[model samples]
Target: MKTDDLISMLAAGNPAPPRAPSARRFALALFCGLLGALLLMACLFGVRKDLAEVAATPLFWAKVALPAALVLGALWASGRLARPGVAVGARWAAIGVPVALVWGASLVLLAALPAGDRLAQVLGTTWRTCPLNIALLSVPAFIAVLWAIRGLAPTRLRLAGAAGGLLAGALATLVYCLHCPEMAVPFWGVWYVLGMALPTFAGWLLGPRWLRW
Candidate 1:
């Protein structure tokens, strides 16, 4: 057979791969992870007693918004990374911008506060518990998201793992807002990032071992 004709014949023999499998798996993972995080939060901490009042406050939304933005970026990066040779590209920016904004807000607030009060704001009342709670809450998401990633083909296991971990961490953080009373930007900038970091680091460490397929 002629080279071009042979190539055409081989191409015609294989159907194009389906496009939506990645989307479906990720969507399902997001739903399940979020539900699990919510349940864990409710069972473990209970919703903060003043949720109704707090929900009306802008700071509450700001807390929710920060992680929500990371979730979007991480989800995108994870989905793309699940497929071999896909570049993460602007998705890195998506995850980074929210964190940058939160930190910037925190610095501004710190600058405006009295020096003595600055320590209290950064520490908050629950600095010790906040990140710990976030990391604890990330357990369900960590499992669900990594499972989702493993089901697909990921060439860069560590990055894909980190992305999956971040997605879970962000989802957990979003749910955590319901129970976390610390509304200070400095608190979120410090503890919230640390909380999410635990899972992300774990995923990066485990991706090669866990995600090999």
Candidate 2:
């Protein structure tokens, strides 16, 4: 058969179906991960006793917002990275902006306090466990988000993996807020970020192996 005839036959009645939007896949993945995190948190430490009271407080939402913002930014970055040949561009800035804001707030808060009080604010009662808990909670989400990314077309495995991992960490950190008692900005600026970083760095390290298409 002629080339034109062959091409026409190949393009005939079996039209390709539309693919699901990446946002929907990511949303489902994130929701699953959040559920897993919630279940894990409930079993491991349970939500804080005064959660209802704290929920009414502005500081509580502020704490929740930090990771929520990172989640939004990382979602944008990860979605771009999951597609082949896509430039991450300004989308990546979404991740850093929240960290910068928290760090800035932390610095101002620390500077305003007396030196002795500053250390306590930064260290909080749960300083040692905060990051560990956040990282631990991120495990489920990390698995979920990476699974979602892997099912798609991610060209830059390392970057895509890192973005996915950050998304997981930010999401888990958001859930962590429900259980975490510490509300100090300094504590969040330091430990909460560190918790999220653990998974992001892990993704970078494992990207080649884990995210390989």
The candidate scoring highest on lDDT is: 1
Worst 10 residues of 2 by lDDT: 13-22
Against the reference, the lDDT scores of all candidates come to 0.86, 0.85
lDDT of 1 by residue, 20-108 (tens): 87688888888888899999998999999999998998878988999989999899889888765568886699989999999999999
TM-score to true structure, per model: 0.91, 0.89
Q: Write the per-residue lDDT of candidate 2 for residues 100-151, one digit (tens) a residue.
A: 9999999999999988799999999998998889889999999989887776
lDDT of 1: 0.86
Model 2's C-alpha root-mean-square deviation from the true structure amounts to 5.4
Clashing pairs in 2: none
